[model samples]
Target chain A: MKLTVTIAGVELKNPIMTASGTFGSGRDFEPYTDLNKIGCVVVKGVASREWAGNPPPRIVETYGGMINAIGLQNPGIDVFCKEDIPFLRQFDTKIGVNISGKTIDEYVEVAERLASEDVDLLELNISCPNVKEGGVAFGVDPFMAALVTGAVKKVARQPLIVKLSPNVTDITTIAKAVEDGGADAVSLINTLIGSRIDIHKQKFILSTRQGGLSGPAIKPVAIRMVYEVANAVNLPVIGMGGIMSGEDAVEFMMAGANAIAVGTANLLDPAATMNILAELETFMRNKQIEDVNDIVGVVNKAAISP
Target chain B: MNQSINRSRTVCKIISNRPLVDQVFEIILACPEIVKKVRPGQFINLYCRHSGRLLPRPISVCEVDLRNGHLHLIYAILGKGTEEFSGYKAGETMEIMGPFGNGFNLDSSDGNYLIIGGGVGTPPMVELCKQLKGKKTIVAGFRDNPYLVDRLKQYGDVYITTDNGSAGFKGHVVEFIEQRGLKGTIYACGPAPMLQGIQAYAKKHGLQAYLSLEERMGCGFGACVGCVTKVVADTDTGWRYKKVCKDGPVFDAGEVLFP
Candidate 1:
């Protein structure tokens, strides 16, 4: 069975990759599972300079998932290149570095810096909802999103994947915008802007009063958006948001995603990617499917007929 | 730090899950792997099987019976996750990831050890008092109806205080310590207000104190970087984020900013 899927000229052993921000350079999870077994490990979002992030309580549990306003805290690019990259290079799996910034210049600088690095892919994060500056700013507007994508694509040596925000009304418009600007691929849906109030305290649960919602609760919305973006753009689509099982990954593939990244599920189970990979393989073997790519965009047309 | 990084994850069977008071409960797990490595202030990220509750609950190690291979976890039903844990019964096995985070630093000091705890924070102190070598005095504060007094008594001189004066002292635990004029190396785990109060008292009396902080955790290991506490950095205008899970659930009272 062929599990390998190529995205923007980079060949992954499998289509399974850990979503950015959820898997932190694969260090802490080394004890629970081997990093090489999975297709790729996308490290946490890193900026040109260190960000202190927000103050606690930054995370809160909702009904089917959790909300986080982490503000993309990370050790600057120098530290990441020196420490994180070498550590990740020891593993056999491909490495995808998730890059974020407050301004267009900052994004370009980060892309330029990682251009000479050992990473296989660069995921430009223009859609982080927690931060006040730069995150949702570039994401909410199609022109700004395309501008940032074009700027990064000019300097990035590795293939660039623009992570899309779900806060906007029309996601396909933004996907097409990034595609028009020369983006190698696009990943969605980042996180929906959400909030929860503490009834007894009469205050917001998150310190920031709002956060990005991720987990099982957001899976259906993610699938629908992925389907839309996949049909709208020529660029390869990486679908995410609340993927918990191998079957869920398969569903994303059916929705026309070339690959799937597991985010909140990693926080729930440290070995989630490995388990999902095993389950995906088992599913293929059981169904007598030889190539995994055969199932991509295989959803029945009549199912969604009005 | 590197040695502590790869500590094993275990699926241990629950021996008992019973309530101690109105909202608090004690859970004993039959996992020798985790019991062998746990220290006074260390914690375990307990996985809950309930639907929709994905994150693991970070519960401090209350006690460790090495002989019987039982790890004790004392936690309160603060939210939906703990509420699910409250329903867990004996014979059910759950996956636990820790023995993570740095425990209380056991130094060879020349003073007496004053162990203080408030509310749900009292659990970790049970193990600390039991392991300390020198003179120990345990002071526990509760809103009302104290539990685990007998277990604490085995380690040190136990002092209890409740909000309604139903127990040993009438007021807060910090006030009780001040009233007794106890001066020694202090260790504490409690609500932010209580820890802040203790920090002030420790500064006034010039006593060395260690405090355990609680934050909403993601990975329960250092990876997520979700559980961060502000600390003094080396620069002039200095405050940087440190992982509460990796750097500490316990930090020196002098270095930590309670706000």
Candidate 2:
């Protein structure tokens, strides 16, 4: 069966990609999961300059998922090129860099810095909720979302995929806004705002108080958002949020996502991506499906009023 | 790709899960591959049967039964994940991915060792104590009567300290060290306060020391820059977060900034 899927003019060998921030520039999962097997390795969010990230207690386990306020801690673009890029280039899979910045200029600067670098695509991470500024700001509003996308698109050397936050009221508006701003593709939903209180301690578990929630718990919300966005925009949609198994992946594709990403599942099992790919293939064979892309948006429905 | 990494997921069967003391249990898994590769202080992320609690709990290697191809993991019933783990039956299988993180460096020189572990951290010291070559003295701290001290006693002279004075000395490990005038190249893994006290004592005594740190982790491997600890940095930021999961669960007592 043909598993190949296209996103933003780039033809991925398979529709399976590691969600940015979940996979650490391909180093963390390099041991168990081969980089060549998956469609792409979307590295963690990197800024133009190094970020220290938040203080301790950045993660807490919830019912079906975990919350993280990692604050996009990275060694910056220079380190990414020197350390991660060479390592990833050795693999046959496509590389997608997730860029994080505190301002529109910072976003543009990150895009410009990677402009000449050899990479497959750029994912503008304007939806990270842990930071004080930049990430959640540009993503929550349609104006700011479009503005950041337009600015990054102008300078990005590779096709741009704008990752959207699910914390907003209207995810479709922001998806359409990024599409208007020249985003080659749109990926959603980037974790719902979630919090956990330690009843014993009677305090919040995470230092940030609220963190991005991703896991099987948020899968249904992601599907709904993916379905709506696919119908609302002409841009290709990359669906992600708590995808754990091959069956869950097929469900996302059927909900109108051209490709799907594996996020929190990677943490639970670094081999999750490879396992997911095999499971997806197995699913296709069992269903007598000839091509993987043939199942995209199969759960056809008209866009609900937004 | 570099040729060194061979990490993969394996479903290992449990051989035993019995409580050694109040709320503390020792689980033995018949995992030959992991036992063969596990160093003294290395850890494994153990998964439970619950679908709601997704992330696997990180448990240290308590002992290595190389002859039987068994791995011992001791854990306290602290949180829901571990509590769920406490109920696992012997015949049931658990999925795990590790032998991850850097284990303690049993530096071969001089080798007069002072192994210190506190509370739940004490279990890892059992494996560590077994591996040390030269003079070994182990000090473990707990809230009450110690459970693993017997296992530790098999390898070295074991000292115990309790917060309630119900067992051994009525104090923390550092206080016990002060009373005994303990001096050696120190190796320790414990809570932040105990580790900080050890760092200070080691610095004041001018002794070489190694520390294993514990932090809230996101992914037990290197992804998700969660589980970061402050470390001394020379850059403008002065101190930066190094992944406790990757850079350490073990660090030089001197290099870590407990502040």
Candidate 3:
């Protein structure tokens, strides 16, 4: 009957957390779902200074997914500490702030600013493709990823969780690199780079011409990457990408994710995280499973006979 | 600037869905709760059950019939989302959220008001026309066939135009307004070009105006920040991104940047 799992020393009542950028500090979704029920609330990416983001037409829908180039638009860290932290403190859930910047210094400054803040965890965003600067640069290479992870870990008062990019050739190398760099935990598969073109206009749908693809279409790729990273690294893994239901969370857990995040599904429905958590609890009861942790990486625990 | 407290998504029964013009259709949902709360210019996000389409379609409230508790919506087929909506029939259900977005700022109800709509943008003006307390005139422009004129006529003096000269006038909405020498506090919604023309014209004539805008959106709530529009900001860049879903599908015409 227990659903508790700790992510990097932070004790969460359950393993359910809203993916950063999709939950927006829980202000807009306050009416849609109960924040108290969730285990953790991960706010969107914030930088040391405000980012204007890309021009209009930032998102476009494809077959089973959507692509976005929001460019990590935010009101900056000062605004987050003053506004978001106080609002989230009113909730019963643990707070995880997603931090991003165009340079290593900018990223470190943001983490340092939140060093004395009330956040429970800090998720470093190094995979945003819409921006022209440091995010993709630091994430695509293992050495750069480790460097940023180490730099932020030095200043961050809260436990640091490095969010990884799926655009690289090998995700495991980056996972292990961060582990060696002193990262408390690692969250993976932050959107695959993709694009959509308008046949009639003969132009790209996104203003940036390319964006991160998310939703159900990218689930298979996310699952494969989560499985690989979970096996390669000893650090606890937070798996995400195209998770829409309780079954989706279970699938990620089976693939070695200590916890799973609800991202694109929140865009589909504001209350999706709650519905998913409810379904996950229902799944546990139905299966007669006593501990939720018993199911983590269950697929890898029992390999198929080759 | 925030949503009405404790808003929940509702699966309303589809009362009716039928084509109004070649590609445009009118749908009615049997939800009394939404009927009681919606204001002109507020929108609802319609969720598609199709697995491929994750983002909900935010459509403006065309009409709110409180007596019958029926909410009317008008949409034109543009892509797979609308194409799928076009096929929705009665006896079925739809998942919808909101009455979101700060509704139109209704002020000086007795003042002169001009409501303009271009193509698909005209639908939201119907409810605006009904609620305005001032002397109101509606100017709606269409590409070809003009639908919703009948409903619009019930609330105000309705002016119509079509590109093919199939309706009341043969010119565009702005051209018709200029030709007729009409000036007032204007409210509008339309394509980028049409909205830009209105914003320019309003500024030249020293008139205050409000406009409804559309953008490609992810989470039709504030969270995604994917559907942003350029707005006048006090920052060094002189502008910043505002969520079209949460901040607006409506903004002061002067503050919105056409570029």
Candidate 4:
């Protein structure tokens, strides 16, 4: 019953982690569940400077999920290091800091700042669709993706995990590009670029008109992309999109992800990460699985063998 | 009272869920944890047990019966999430997390409390009015037919206005405020237009006002940063985003920038 999983030399007690933006450095959800029960807490995206984010009406409910154009609102590295880092350090779980910026220099600066911090890993965010600038740019293009990955890798003291944007022509190319750029691992998919309209008002639902779609609706696409990236790159893959339950996390692992991050589900249930972990363990016990790692990429083997 | 109340997720049994007016419903839940912590202007994020409705619907605390350990939530059938709530019946249960956001600061001033609420925003004011001492005047504006006037009457002198003039005062609530010349520290909530009108009215009279705002929210807690409103700042560029779910669902009337 070994549930522990290793990603880029870091060992997590379990495979369940909170997705960036959904869990704000583990402070918000502390009331509902114990932070020590989670394997890792992937906090919201942090930039070199404080981000004011976007205007109001930043989120809207769709059919199976929701859309958000938060524009990566954060308190910047200085405040995050001062406040969020110390708060998260009280927990037993590993810490994965998600970095966002409008340029390579901003990314490198934040990475360098966190270089001496007590974080366990650095998640390079090049695929945030809500921001107008650097987020989707580096992620959508292979060359730029590699360039940013290489730039951050130089200063990032923690093992770098490049998060890929789902709004791309070929995700594998970008995944390969980061691997070549010396990334320790990769996480996909950030979010799909989508929009919704208010028929009654005859206007876009989100103030930004377009937003990144997440939740159960994007789970299928995320699983597909994770499968593709895991096959294309040698790096370990952390899969996330719309993981709602323990079954969903297991599905992602079987599809070729070493671990899974719970995103929009945390919004619905604050204790989602711990609940999903229990569900994952229940899933293991029922299936007579000794090690959770035994299920990783198992679907691919079945698909190829037969 | 605990300064920092820990938010919890619990299954609250429904004591009653029935229509109050057209597309408006009143639900009473028996949850002591929520009833104990909830203050006026605080909200609860309600989860619809029905599958496919993944996001929680944020509803303000309309009333708290501490003796019975029951909490009252009044909401309109605005969309699918609420429509599902409309279908829930007594003996049923639903998941909820709360009492979130900074509740109204009850200690601001000693002036007569002018509690103005429009449509669904009227509910939270009921609780606020009940707890306040001294003179309390409640002015409520509805789209057409008014609901909850009787409950509001118990707390103070209740004034009513309807869009179609089918009720107490003819025309908009702001028009009623303009004509009546009511004097007090204004505590208001409603659509942006109504709040903007109140903000203007407060400025003209040199009165302090507090407004409760509504926005599309993700996590009812502060995590997602999806529910933000622009507020006046002192810097050269004069505005910054504050979480409506955390920094406020209630804000100083003069500080909010209504667009």
Candidate 5:
């Protein structure tokens, strides 16, 4: 049997979701994927207001990864609901809107507006740092996470999933605060803050100077954080970071995440999500696993008597 | 836009790889899948065979012999990627990841089509001309001789300008456009300075112009967001940033926010 997951009473065919911003508007990846087969698609983060994003030099490539300070450039929620959502409706898969707000009121207001729309879930991205404030602010502090999650929960009748940032010192403390504030579920491991200087240019590659680091370089860190957060909260945890293959996705599932999201891998291959799904099925079949859920957090191992 | 294009890496053989000019290579790869659907102004990200090569390099598809399933890439030896590529022999193979990036809009409804190119920018213009298939005038600029004269015949109604006057008109491509009283839609690609010159002249004459920008890119797709160019717009999203590899390597000339 296939793995199934429920978020706020909505059934997802699988437990894998594409992280926001990595997958362009759903239309870009639809050709590479059978949308109905995947569990969900997280659209690019839609700020309460449209964002122009950072200036040029917004991205720098590290050895195995990249850093981007795109500053949440997006068409606002209103445009998303009006212009973008219609396309998502055509896909049989669940559509999750990743939202960012610069202020508490903005979060509540956007949530209230989105409640009327047909989004299956709301992924509150409170970790974007390149913006004026709200992103990293809400994500870094326990109090801020609670306040923002609570504010959105008040107006949002739909399922709310707070996406946690990896920049925090204590991710569990922040995750606990959001859970306390009434968030239904949570996703862990947004990009870590990083920057690279072009020594030859004698300047930062990104116009913003600093951006979020992601890709295979951050996978181990993400797995650790997801394990920590899953241990801290009862909510279903969505895990991601440096996930390039289906085997990588299975590793995250074994690391204690209920579901996984693929981010940087999508950059290398637009058909990454579908490719991962196929690889996961093949792994499950080869391992003689009847259901995917049986492998989720199947990391308990007895010490070998050497 | 319902275009379903994306990126991939294919191990392709170098059918015929040779230098077109000093340090400029004309590499023909046997990539059947990529060659079949390639349009003008589109490019490929080639992974060079060296650890020192940091990322894949972008080279515009200069020509495509579709019937033969061959794609030609024209590039100059500027970095490790191209430098390493210069060493590869015909029949040797390398991983080619592309036919990535949006190309020029092929619509030629406007009567008088004007094209401007400088250096390597001339390659994409060749493809654009093939697509235009209309009455279009080309104003090509190069820095020196031999190079300008060698490729001038490929364009239609060509106006040539060389910095040293070793070629046709002794001025810039933009100067030639102004001197010739050029009009209608303009499509251009070149170094930033030349593009800036063309954009200014086009804006002054109220001509619709599209420019293909060359920005240093890491991932030649939307994923890295490395190749973003700012555009002037009238909305809250004051800056319109499009991925050169995803949304376009070609965009309206006036849309570019000249940096």
Candidate 6:
């Protein structure tokens, strides 16, 4: 059984991509695993202009999770265009550009620029915590989400996947709004908003009081949200949050996700992307599945059905 | 993309075995691949046994002996993970990866180099000394009779300072630097206060200074941006962040924004 997946017009050998921020522009993890083997590689988050990111203590490790406030630190759009994106094009794997912005125009500007070029997909990441305006603001509000989506949709020539933030009262509403605004697909449950305090230091480990949480701890919430958004919106859903294993990947697939992105897992294991791809293949071979897409939404609700 | 790194290692010995000090022994199986690649300020990540240890421990590669194929790692018994690492011995293997991350870039062109290291931080400077083949003065500070300086005598000019003056210099390493009229580039590592003093001294004299910082690292590699040192850019905002594990474990003293 071939575990091939095509999301929002881009073909993926597998659904496991090293999430936007976790994997550094294909340089760090290139040593551990074959970059071409694992589905697509979503490079680091790129902003319309250059960004220096946040202050010190960008990340903290909790019991089962890690909190990060890495404020979308990238070399900006110009550098990405001239330096990163050009280097990324050399790889055979699908290249998805994750874009973030402070204003709707910034988002559109980045999307418009990316659109002019040939990219497999564009993921609108609107969940950065360190930024003041836009980011989570656009994500939490369904109207703002649609507005940004609509703005980018007008000029975006490549497949647009609106990455939905999990920091909303009702994510389903935002999901539908973005779908209505013309998103080809949606990747759901970006890091949940959370914080950790140190008793000894008597202050937050992260200089920023709160940070977005991701890792093995957030998998359940991510899956539930993916299911919710999947039910609400008609677009294909890309699910992710603490997907560490193939079984976890399958769980998301059964929960109505068309594909999944591996975020925090890659940090835990250097070779996680390729490892999950091989594990997914092994799973397909054992289950005797013909096509990987057929398993999407194939929920095992034996107890619930009975 | 190349699937394997040029250098890699495995932890052959663990050290729940108690040493004289509150330290753990993570004796690496073979140091050849790692030792050959490691420079002064580089570190190795010892993958401890999966008995509850989730994060790999980042220890300064104290001494690398390519001939014996052993890299000695002495870590303070901080937690359960480190305590467990101190116990394991020969034949038992733990995943060890490295000679990873950028190291100290020391340029001793003038041959007039001043080296200062505090406590456990002195070990890394050993390699830096080996590379220096000229008039170099080493000023090492320790709490009491920590076994770092006694063995470091063969490197270059050796000067020791204990907190209680149980060692060489009665005061501090900086005192020795002041008394000796140590000039030229200064390379320092150790506790924050010592590094800060060195930074201030360098600033006063307008001399070049570099310092290696230690942070509570989660990944040792850049993946988990846990270990971070505050750096003040000379620009308008006057400050930025750089990963100590990646961007530098060693940096120009003038570059660091001391809190």
lDDT, ranked from best to worst: 4, 1, 2, 3, 5, 6
Which ten-residue region of model 2 chain A has the weakest summed lDDT?
A297-306
lDDT of 3 by residue, A1-306 (tens): 998999999999999988888888899888878899898999999999888888878888888888988888888988889999999999999999999988889989999999888889999998888889988889999999999999999999999999999999999999999899889999988988999899999998888999999888999999999999999988889999898889899999999999889998887777788888888988999999999999999987589643
Task: Assess candidate 1 and give its lDDT.
Answer: 0.89
Chain B TM-score against the true chain B, each candidate: 0.94, 0.95, 0.94, 0.95, 0.91, 0.86
Displacement of residue B205 (Cα, Å) in model 3 is 1.1
lDDT by residue for model 4 over A185-231, one digit each (tens)? 99998978889999999999898999999999999999999999999
In model 5, pairs of residues that clash are: A57-A206, A57-A207
Model 5 scores a C-alpha lDDT of 0.80
DockQ winner between candidates 3 and 6: 3
lDDT for model 3 comes to: 0.88
Model 5 per-residue lDDT at B139: 80
Q: Estimate each model's TM-score.
A: 0.96, 0.96, 0.97, 0.97, 0.88, 0.91
- Report the CAPRI category for model 2: medium
lDDT of 5 at A253: 84
> Each prediction's Cα RMSD?
3.1, 3.0, 2.6, 2.9, 3.8, 3.1
* Model 2, C-alpha of A222: deviation from truth (Å): 0.3
Which of candidates 2 and 4 is the stronger one according to DockQ? 2
Give one digit per residue, the lDDT tens place, for model 5 in B51-151.
33436788888778888899888888875568889999998998777777878887758867898888888877776776676677888887774343345
What are the candidates' interface root-mean-square deviations? 5.6, 4.8, 5.0, 5.8, 5.8, 4.5
Judged by DockQ cut-offs, the docking class of candidate 4 is medium
The segments of candidate 5 whose C-alpha lies over 4 angstroms from its true place after superposition are A7-9, A300-306, B1-11, B45-57, B77-88, B94-102, B109-113, B131-139, B142-149, B157-185, B216-226, B236-239
Q: What's the iRMSD of model 2?
A: 4.8
Error of 3 at A205 (Å): 0.6
Could you give the CAPRI-style class of model 1?
acceptable
Which lDDT tens digits does candidate 4 get at residues B25-73?
Answer: 9999999977999999999999876677777899999999999999999
Worst 10 residues of 6 chain B by lDDT: B1-10
Model 3, which residues run further than 4 Å from truth? A304-306, B1-7
